[model samples]
Target: MATHLITGASSGIGAAVTRRLHTRGDTLWLLARNAGRARELAAEYPGAHTLVGDLADPGRLSWAFGHQSPPQELDSLLHIAGVVELGPIGDLTPKIWNEQLAANLVGPAELTRLLLPQLRLARGHVVFVNSGAGLNAHAQWGAYAASKHGLKALADSLRWEEKPNGLRVTTVYPGRTATPMQEKVHRQEGKEYDPALWIDPESVAQTILLTLDLPRDAEIQDVTVRPGS
Candidate 1:
């Protein structure tokens, strides 16, 4: 069975993907800031383990990994943890910009770097759970959009640079989805949250599974999913 580690594993797309992987009998290492939720997930899935730490904290992340005593190699690393701070460019404070960048870009990049040795040994795949914002920015979403755009760039650079090492990188740009994060977005926008108007997190998770299950010689470099509505 393939082994994988997923960030933001306690909810939304991350939780959905974790369930899908667990159902497929894959060994999973779940990392989330919610220790209680992570423990709940671990109890539900036989091969699932928990790493409780904030994604933005490098030292905590490293310590969490060490506590679990994970295997030397992993078949996949899914960077699904991110923060969304929506505000106008003028309204954005340095603190908001720094927090968004730390969680959405820098933290994931550093974590990936830490796992590069294991990934190289396994010739594994890396998936970045980006957003439509990663493709284009919107008003009142300057900070979040910029961070996502940076994420997109990170994925592009990683894909090109890791080619010789047989590493695959896939960036999934999903449009608005029905999740707690989306609810927050809806609140921020003063609009009603409609699940029907958004893509299902399970659908996105399934696409990720499909990419992972592709033949070793072939790779899906990028994916974009959106609601029909």
Candidate 2:
């Protein structure tokens, strides 16, 4: 079985993927900002281990990546962890933009740098669970859009760099998902974005695992998943 490390493992799609992979006997290393949440998730799986702290903090990220123990050999890394904040361009604050950038871009970039050795050893895959906002534009989704764009660029560049080494890099741009973060954004927008109409977390996990298990010739650089409804 493959070993995977994931961020934003406290909730949303990360949580779902954690459960799915754990049941399949895959070792998981979880990274998150909240110790309590990380511990809670760790408790759910017999061998699951979590690195509790903020990824935005370089020192903290160093601690988590360099210091934390994995449940098993660390292989793939699922960059599912992200942050979304909404406001019109005129009203958006630099603090918010920087915060999201730190969480959504720098954090993942730095963590991947730290874990590249292990991933290289396994010849593993790197999954970027980015948002459609990374590919499109929205009135108040400026911060999210910028961060995701950076994330996509990062994934693409790394994909090229790792091709000779036989590592697979995929970016899954999800349109809408029924996740806690989605709910938070929906509520912030003061609109009802039906969760039922949104993509299913379990389905996303299924797709990711399937893609990861595909034959060496079958490479999907990016997969766009939009809600059916």
Candidate 3:
């Protein structure tokens, strides 16, 4: 089992992945913005470790990782922490736009950069939990769309740089997951979104496990999981 470091470990897909890793008996390091929730999960699982930090402050990423009690000797990094800020392109405030970019795009990039030496030591993998919106586009998802697009591009470049170091990169494009983020979108869309169309969080975690378990010589370059009809 891989020793993994994941962000956004408190709930939704991050929490689901945490459970999957727990059941597999893997050591996990988790990042949560909220201390209460993080500690709650830490209490639930024996070896689950939590690091509290805000991804919105890109500069603090290195410091956050640096200050961990036990330095993360992570075999893989599942960059699962991300935020979706929505507003019409015309009215998208600069503050929200920057925060979204920092959290969803910059923070992940910086964390991977800071942790990559450790990952290289283990010949590990970096998994980007990208969104379907990252690959395509939406009408009013200005900040969210831009951040994910940046994420997709970053993953592509990292795949090339890190592949030679025995690092495997997998970008999973989850389509309209039934997480709190999706709830926000659904609320915004009102009658437009069908509840039947949202993908389950557990399914995303399962696919992540499957990707990680693939043979050393091979790689599943990408996986797109949509809700079942």
lDDT of 1 by residue, 93-212 (tens): 999999999899888987898789899899999999999999998899898998899999999999999999999999999998898999999999999998888888999999888888
TM-score of decoy 3:
0.94
Q: How do all the candidates rank in terms of lDDT, highest first? A: 1, 3, 2
Residues 117-224, model 3: lDDT tens digits:
889989898999999989887788878989999999999999999888989999999998878778877777774655557888999999998988888989987899
Q: Which ranges of candidate 1 are over 4 A from the true structure?
A: 34-37, 63-68
Clashing pairs for predicted structure model 3, backbone only: none
Q: Where does model 3 exceed 4 Å of error?
A: 70-72, 192-196
lDDT of 3 at 59: 93
- Residue 66's lDDT within candidate 3 is 66
Clashes of 1: 0
Error of 2 at 144 (Å): 0.8
Task: Give residue 71's lDDT in candidate 2 (0 to 100).
Answer: 41
For all the candidates, what are their Cα RMSDs to the real structure? Answer: 1.6, 1.7, 1.7
Error of 1 at 61 (Å): 3.2
Q: How accurate locally is residue 24 in candidate 2, as Cα lDDT from 0 to 100?
A: 84
